[model samples]
Target chain A: MEISKGWNARKKKQLQVIIAFTIVPLFLLILFTYYPFLEMIRYSFYNMKYIGPRKFVGWRNYVQVFTRPDIIRTLLLSLYYMVGSVVQVALALYLATIFCFKVKGENLWKGFIFFPYLINGIAIGFIFKFFYTRGFVLDTVLQVIGFDLENLPYWLKDQKINNWSLVFTSIWRYMGSNMVLFLGAMMSVDDTLYEAASLDGANKWQTFRHIILPSIKTIVTLNIILSITGSLSAFEPPYVITSGANGTGTFFVVMNDIAHTSQKVGLASAMAVFLLFVIIVAKFVQDALFKYIFRNADTDDESADVARARKKAQKAAARKAKGGA
Target chain B: MAKTTAAKVRHHYSAGTIIWEIIKYASVILCSFIAILPIVSCVITAAKTPEEYQTTNVMTPPANWLNFSNYLEAFKTANMGTAFRNSLIILVFVLLGSIIIGTQLAYVLNRFKFPGNALIRNMFTFAALLPGIAMQVVVYEIMTNLHLVNTMYGYIIMMCGTDVMSIYIYIQYFENLPVSLDESAFMDGASYFRIFYSILLPLLKPAIVTNLILKGVGVYNEYYCANLYLQDKRALCTVATSLYTFTGPLGSQYNMICAGVIMSLLPALIVFIALQNQIYSGVAAGAVKG
Candidate 1:
């Protein structure tokens, strides 16, 4: 009877501990994330300000989000970023592949490139602002390379090239981190595979395609999805450097303007909700596309084939060397 | 005959391999140069006097490399001392809160087989899918309701509140920890709280470090929420927003602005250089798990 009572007490104590540990985090999650998300959806249907009467205006704000020319233009600006993300991924992959091999001062190179990712975003903005200023760093560098100062366009002032410039900045800031991620994934690829590839007389590109690519496919897919969605919501470069001037206002920047500057809380909420919907759709599409692409590339089957191929290649190479001898 | 064959094989691949190596080094060097070029420009400009800045090409070396005027001016004018103080306060509190909340929640979720455990896990997983930036509009409203707008404690709480990643990390870490540790402690007549605090928490050092580095960098550099919620710029300016002070009335002073940028970059640069390995591995591990 005493032992039963002790067991009951312990169970109660465990329950109390669980509640104590979980309650605050759960409350925070609900309050800050889930509750706000639901509120955002509700707010999307009403015409309101921060501190004023809210009237139910069914789907009007969302209609404006779709139809408004300025907002539409901002959405289109994502195309630049989408292109940039593709380039970013390619560059990062290339660097990662190269660095995975024996290289002198590998850590130094990685540190130099990855340092930008560690810098404060606002500081990067200010640095680039000075960089792209007329007759400043970029133009001066060009002049040293035999181009005239007069030939250089105002990098921030010119609408045509400014977005590209901003995209380049995004690429610069992000590419290294992506490279580091790819490198980390690549480093985990079995060492024997690379040795076998070399023994089979496979060159660098062939080895990369057959060995490294297959091994790191998951990370690659992840990086792509992240970059694409990130492009759709690109904010910092335009927000900080140009203040969304010269046709660089991204979707988030526009929504920020609406919510804060114009005090159109309802409209802004609608835009936010619309973006969230688009992101979800994008994520689903990417997942489906990846599934389609990788349908036949199951790990078990691939590894089996690779093992068999490696054995065959090793036997052939040994036979060829024996014949030559 | 075997020696000749081996030599021939080496000769066959050496030329191509050499060229490939050259290309690889060239690309790495070029990329490293490009990455540092802008910051290098900022550093160069930060050293120049106002007159020197206007006269000299940006790539030119400043007449006086030791010019401290711009640094002093930017620091004073931007009120960066206060900004750093606020940012440090925010970082300390947010990291502490996040670590505590994240670890405790992770412990509960991992060690217990309770009724709502799976539901709670699913809730967090689903929350991760929700685009956080998109929900800021309503989050702003909620903050206003809570009177958290423009207050440091409010910002700290809000920052701590959104730390889903840290919780995930802790949970992943906790999975590797043997539950036998808890069982053994319980067998020693240690209470549940005692087991958690004394035994399990000490074992969570790695997860704690990873969370600290990742969350520390994020909270330190977060600009959007800091700007929106901390509307009283003078009182609530962080290192991220303090630099924006240069963007307004002092916008044209590139030298001064560059100095401010360099100053802002310094602490992070120092930390990264010191903890490059930790930061890299932590980020890689976190990204893979997340």
Candidate 2:
């Protein structure tokens, strides 16, 4: 009883020490990371295009984004990118399932499938550019099918098809990461469950649908969120592939326009703010649904406040002994 | 006993054999080939003569292949050397600074209950959720104001905004850990810095190493920020930007671009492969602790 009381007193001391060092840095995080976010919100209310903004306009920027044809076209292009990403993720899921079984040099196949993902988008963009420009790709195939080589449309040249080409490369880059995530989820299923299903005379499709699908539901949500967020924030390849002139792939081309070319800092900030809100609100909605319901299948809740308090107590006790001396 | 033993061995064999046989080696081989075709296309294109490259289909084998000078041209023509150096410089410091700053910030945030604890948590969460494009806007403004635009420090500073993944990863791992180890250190009269450096940092190695790889990978691969903030041809060019010189309004160099890409890609590729095990068991494979 005496020892327990002493331990408790010492733990309290350690917690005190951790809090002392933590104060200034935490303030800085709030100042820089969070404060700018608030500034983003405030900036959204104005046409603060050149930093010297005194006029107050309410919701007009968002109104312009929604009603304007150019912005709408950009939004649809962004949606097109999402569709391409979804298809890529589905393709990855299909391929990962195919690779789940035993095979010769299984590791090699997995590595190969995942290779495109690790390459820099600029490099991939350059390679795809080479294929599109003077050599054979879709254009080559088109030529074989009787289109003239000299007048062949750049595979990524057309505004209509540029988004597709960009998204295909995006998928190529990210599908491996998706596959690995889902594959990890797949590997977690207990062998006993499959054995029991086999004993019950389940066919391959039935076993897959009944066992595999149910097991990966939580992971599917995670992947969906990743895909949605990834598409919305898409850049790099399109920047390299399109070089931003065609205005084909993402609405975020506005961001580059505002920054590097046009120098419309305020307009860029407005676009950025809108994009941020869309992502955060969407993620929060998913997160809320996730915890209220998806929390049923998967468990990961102990790392919040209780964890913070526990670590603080541990550090406080270490500072006291030297102070006593 | 022999009959039972034989039956048990048979049971294990029967379970996976049919399932494995359905997909088998051929399907796997074909998928693998399809997967490698793009990279293979890139490699082949790099080796082909410019004249041959212009006329031949990339998917088709070249009639003649040789030491393509386009790569030599890529370096001389694309200004790749300066870009490569700038990328290297940013890669070194951004990786170093982000780890140092982010981990120390995380350590404090995860370990303390300071006055603005809720605000701090919200700040980290907000930054994580900050629209990548939107954040770039504010960062551009800030970088410009600080005169950091086109500078290496700008890249490193802009990178300081990070997701909650590292903190939460540390928090989760730390939560699972028994606090007995820290207690011994505490009983020895160590300061917070001592406790953090000697004990907590070591304890959080698995998470630290994982976050290091994850954070560094994306930042190093970052395209949008670099493209936006830097304009000085020498200042802005990383391997990413250098690769862009291969692309233009005019015809792109076919095979040499691929060689340059392979050169840039090989480091991250090697790291991913080498760290695959650590990466899997690290933050990626595990479920995020709430």
Candidate 3:
């Protein structure tokens, strides 16, 4: 009877602890994340604002998202940022490989490069604004290199150079963190692979291609996909530095303006939903591509094994056909 | 690995290899210089007088590098004292709230075989993938209806609510810790709460540091929600928003703006210099495990 009573007490204690710990966090996630997401979907289907009654506007907001020329143009701007992300990742990979081998004052170089990632996004906006201003930092640096002021293009004014300038800032801010990530992955590669490759008289390029690439393939793919999504939501540099001026308005900037300035909450939500769709599609395509390319590398249960077996059967059939012919 | 690489280096010390080494060093230095050049110019510009600022080139050194009046004026005009104070309050509360919620949730999820375990884990992963900025439409409405706009605690609560990363870090940390410790404690007469508070929490120091660095920097630099929720600029301006006072319609007062920017960057720079290794390792570990 006493043991039964003790068991009951322990069970009650377990129940209380579990409930107390889980309740608040779950509530917060639902309120902030899940519920808002659901409401965003609902709001996109209605003509509404922060104040006033909602009216059902079936598919109108979504239709406007694709039909509006300005919105379509803003979506195209994501391409520029996407290109920048690719270059940034490549540069990060190069630098990570170099740092992994050997270098003097490696920590100092890493610190200098990575320091910008720690700076507040707003501060970077201000710094770049000053840097790009005519007769400012960029012009000064160019002048020191013997370039004439008459021949210099304006950094942030001309539409041609303005977007490129913004893209460079993104690279500067993000390249360091990406480098550190790649470095971590590279270091985690088995050292014996390098030893064996060296014993076989492999060159630097050969070693990198055969061993390093395969080892860090997962992280490389993950970063590429993340950069695509990140580019889709590009807001900070344009929002803070130029306020989306000079044909630099990205998709997110357009959404922010529509929602906040124009008070077109439904339309803005529709734009957001469209961007989310773009990201999801991009991620899906990337996964499918990775699976196709790295067929045996994937750990999926049935599909991957089936793919391998199918490939083997096809090869056998090809051999039989050759022999018969 | 080192010996093999060294042996290869000795054997391959040809003219081509030497040229490649020089190119590598040069490119790394150029990259580093590009990364830091603008901030260096900001420092130079911040020290110049108004007369000198207009007359001299941007990279020109000021006569007095020690002149600190611009920083003082920026602090006074932007009312950065109040901003810093408010930011401190928010930081303390948000950090405490996140650590408590994150650790307890991770502990429960890690220790117990609950019914909704897989569901909750999947929920968090899915939520992280969802573009958080996309949900601002309805979140603004929720905050308004709850009368949370323009209040400190409201902003704090909102900041604490979106902290999925810290919970992820803690969960990752908890998985590595042996479950036998908790099982043994339960076998003893100790209660679940006692076991968590006395035994498990202490072992999580490294995770706490990692979370603190990540979350602290994020909250410190966060301006979007802070700008929206803390609408009363006079009372609740954060370090980020405080810098915007110089960037209004009357044109940017960049002399003062540079000073304020430097001020805002100082704390982070100091902490980074002191804890560079910890920050580097923590960032690396977080990325890998995550």
Candidate 4:
């Protein structure tokens, strides 16, 4: 009887621990994440300010989001970033391929490149502001390399090239980390595959195409998707450096302006919702495209047995075709 | 046969391969140069006198490398001392709160198979998909209602509230830890809290390090929320927002602004140099798992 009572007490203590530990985190998750999301959706359907009365205005703000030319232009600015992200991914993949081989001072090269990823974003903004200033670092470097001072266009002042310049800054800041991620994935690839490729007289490019590319395709796809989604909400470079001037205002920056400066809470909420919808749609399309492209590759989530069977069947079919040929 | 193949491979390193090797090294060198060029310019500018800054090209060496008056002036004018203090305070509380909250929640979810276990996990997973910045409009409203605007503790709490990443990290770490440890501790008549505090928490050092590097850098360098919520520039300015004090009337002073920018970067630079390996591995591991 005494032992039974002791066991009951222990069970109660365990239950208490479970409840006590979980309650606060759950409350926080609900309050900060779900509650705010629901509130944002509700706010999207009403015309409101921060402090004043709110009136129900069904779908009007969302209609404004689709029809407003300035807002539409901001959304279109994502194209620059989308192109930049593609460039960033390509540069990162190229660097990763180089560094994965035996290179002198590999760590030093990587350290220099990856250092920017650790920099404060605001500081990078200020540094680049000085860099792109008239007769500053970029122009001076160009002059030393034999370009005339009169030939150099104003970097930040000219709308034609300013967005591209900002895009380059984003690429510079992000490319190194993406390279590191690619390096990690490549390093984790099975070594025996490389040995087999070399034994088969496969050259470097052939080995990269057959072994490295196929193995790290998942990470490559992931990086592309992440960068594309990230481009849709590009904020820091334009926000900090140009303050969204000279045709560089991204979707988030303009939404921030409307919300804070103009005090249009409802409109901002609608814009936010619209962006979320666009990102979700983009994610789905990318997932489908990747699935279609990588149809023959073994998926990461498949069981080893299933993958091996598939490989065996493929090999048998190949052998039969060779014999017939 | 292996030795012959190795010799043949060595013989295949011809002029074409040599040219390719040269190109590779040159490109790597060029990339590294570009990476540090902007910072190098800023460093040079920070050391120049106002007159020297105006006369010399940006790539030119400062006349006096020891001219640190610009740094002193920038520090004083930008009120950086207070900014650093506030930032440090916020980092301490937010990290502490996140660690405790994240670990406790992870422990409960991992060890117990209660009624709401799957539901809670799904909730967090769904929350990860939600665009956090998009919900900021309503979050700002909620913060205003809760009187959390313009307050440090409020910011700290809000930071702690959004630590879904760290919680996931802890849960992943917990999966590797043997439940036998808990069972053995329980067999010794120890309380559940005792088992958690004494045994399991010590084994979570790696996860803690990873979380620290990720969360510490984020909270330290966070600008947007710090600007919006901590509105009092004089009292609540963080290291991020403190540099903005140079953008108004003092914006044209490149030397002073460069000094301020260098000062802001110094802490992260020092930490990076000190813990480069840990930071790299931590970041890689976090990215892969996340």
Model number with the top DockQ: 3
Per-residue lDDT, model 4, residue A154, is 86
Kindly report, for each predicted structure in the order presented, the TM-score of its chain A compared with the true chain A.
0.90, 0.76, 0.86, 0.87
TM-score computed on alpha carbons, candidate 1: 0.92
Q: For candidate 3, give fnat to 2 decimals.
A: 0.57
Winning candidate number (lDDT)? 1
Candidate 4: Cα lDDT at B126: 68
- Residue-by-residue lDDT tens digits, candidate 3, B1-290: 33567567777598867886898799899999999999999999889888888889889998899888888988988889998899889999999998888899888888887789888887887787677777887898899999999999999998886355677788888998898898899888788999999999999999999888888888999998888889888888999888778777624667778888898888789989998877877677666533
Residue B20 alpha-carbon offset, candidate 4, angstroms: 2.9
DockQ of 2: 0.39
Model 4 lDDT at residue A211? 52
- Give model 4's TM-score versus the native structure: 0.91
Summed backbone clashes in each candidate are 0, 10, 0, 0
**Share of reference contacts found in each model:** 0.66, 0.44, 0.57, 0.58
Predicted candidate 3: interface RMSD? 2.0
Which stretches of model 2 miss by more than 4 angstroms?
A1-32, A51-55, A138-154, A158-160, A195-202, A244-247, A258-260, A291-325, B1-31, B60-68, B79-85, B249-251, B280-283, B286-290
Model 3 lDDT per residue over A95-162, tens place: 98888667778999999998998888888889999998888998889899999988888887789888
lDDT of 1 by residue, A1-325 (tens): 9999988898898899999998998898999898988888888999999787999999999999999998999989999999999999999999998887777798899999998988788988888888898888888888888999887889988998999999999999989988888888887766766666566665676668666787688888877887888888898899888989878999988888888889898898898888878878987898798789778774424565675576566557655765797
Score candidate 3 by DockQ. Answer: 0.55
Error of 1 at B5 (Å): 20
lDDT of 2 by residue, A1-325 (tens): 9999977776676466555545545554554566667777777676656556546777776677677676676776778777977787687677666655434466777777776666766777766675566445556656776888777656676766667777777776777767776767776665555554444444445556655665676767677776777677777677767766676746777566654476555456677777877887888888897888656543323343543353344334333532564
Descending-TM-score candidate ranking? 1, 3, 4, 2
TM-score of each candidate structure, all chains considered together: 0.92, 0.81, 0.91, 0.91
Please tell me how candidate 1 rates in CAPRI terms: medium
Cα displacement (Å) at residue A69, model 3: 0.6
Model 3 spans with C-alpha error above 4 angstroms: A1-11, A191-201, A298-325, B1-12
